[model samples]
Target: MHLYLVRHPRPIVAANTCYGSTDLEVTAEELALAHASLLPVLPKKAVLFSSPLRRCRELSASLAETLGCQAPTYDERLAEMHFGDWEMRSWDDIPRASVNAWSNDMVAYQPGGGESVLQVAQRVRAFRDELSGLNIEHAIVICHAGIIRLLAACEHGLSIPEMALYAAQKPHKIRYGELLVVDC
Candidate 1:
């Protein structure tokens, strides 16, 4: 039940637009940083899975190259929040009222065609349950901050607020992507 929650590398995008689930290119520098930071931190053998988004794909592939292996499998469950009409659009483009609504209660906000935070958690839980049965000693998931946020909140039983803080402060290689030890 060890997991390395990897936030995908940077993407080439405009300053304020959201690119959830979008096809975006990773920069050479990002790939370089991934090599420098994540590769050696991984075990000699590990299971790597990435969000289907292009940025995550490229990031995973970069690490795979460093490890001299093909990129691991793609998992749709790891994809970012489907922002629906807001895909690739800046926050300003989304109605301020709607944004405020989501800020107050995102659980009920499913704009355009996007999913709510709760919905994302539901899917992540299913994914987590599937992982519970695996013989994988180490598993790496290259996904969005939202995915990490939900996993921390639901699986680890942290409140949503605490999960937000954890996600904000944690780096890409959390605990050097180590398997955690809990007495409980």
Candidate 2:
């Protein structure tokens, strides 16, 4: 199975905000630009799947407008890592100790009471496993950067720990609204 892993467009948040899993609103103009940027690269028809977050859901809707595919399937497994108490807080304000812990062991550390990178990777793998049995040839996953990185890492046969490291490497990290294609 081939999936087009698409990160949601730049969210309208303040700089340095730690808003993982927060339901931030996305502007329609941003969504429109993302749709236009994607139209050239996206397959004409494919099943659409998205995180329930407004950013992804709104982008998925825009894609559906051009692709004319069925309604996007909202999957919780595709959500960004939940940042718990850190949600909407400025990144600079998060405790130094917590940041150090996450940097020390990114896969295992759960910063700000949030899920570990490994935990997010596990659910992403679960989503991939579910996709394997489906009858579709092509699918588009409108999700977050973290989820896209994990999926791309898995496609390269990286272990969970290695996946974290892989994601941290410069080239492996995806930009907002960027597309990463992987075969499941």
Candidate 3:
């Protein structure tokens, strides 16, 4: 199966804000640019899936219209990692001790009382499992960078801890509106 993982367009937010699952907005101009860049490269008639967040949902909807497909199917597992108390807060304002603790144990640490990397990986894996069960040969998933990296880690057979470390180092990073093609 072929999977195309797409990151949402750049969000409209204050500088240095920690926003995951915070329901942030994406600007119209930026979203149109994303559509123009991605629409041509995507496979025609591919199954479309997206996180329910506004950022991702907007892209999905636009793509659906351009491709003449039905609205995308949203899966909660595709949502960004929940940052809990850190959502929409400035990163510098978050307690240093909490940040340090997360750094110490990236795989298991639940920062801002939110889901750990391991937890997010588990959900991503579940979504992958569901994807495998589908009979389709190709699909497009519009989601967050975190989940995209988690899925990439899964493809490379990396453990949760290794994925955490790898993500921290910024390897195989996906910029906003970027598409990563994976064969499973």
Which structure among the candidates has the greatest lDDT?
A: 3
Scored by TM-score, the top model is 3
Ranking by lDDT: 3, 2, 1
Indicate the worst ten consecutive residues by lDDT in candidate 1. Answer: 175-184
Cα lDDT tens digits, model 2, 60-123, are 9878878988999999999999877888999999998888878888777788888887788888
Compute the lDDT for candidate 3. Answer: 0.88
What CA root-mean-square deviation does each model show from the true structure?
4.5, 1.7, 1.7
Comparison by TM-score, 2 against 3, better one = 3
Winner of 2 and 3 under lDDT: 3
Off by over 4 Å in 1: 68-71, 158-184
Count: clashes, candidate 2: 0
Residue 30 of model 1 has an lDDT of 71
lDDT at residue 16 of model 2 (Cα atoms): 95
Candidate 1: give the clashing pairs.
none
Write the candidate numbers in order of decreasing TM-score.
Answer: 3, 2, 1
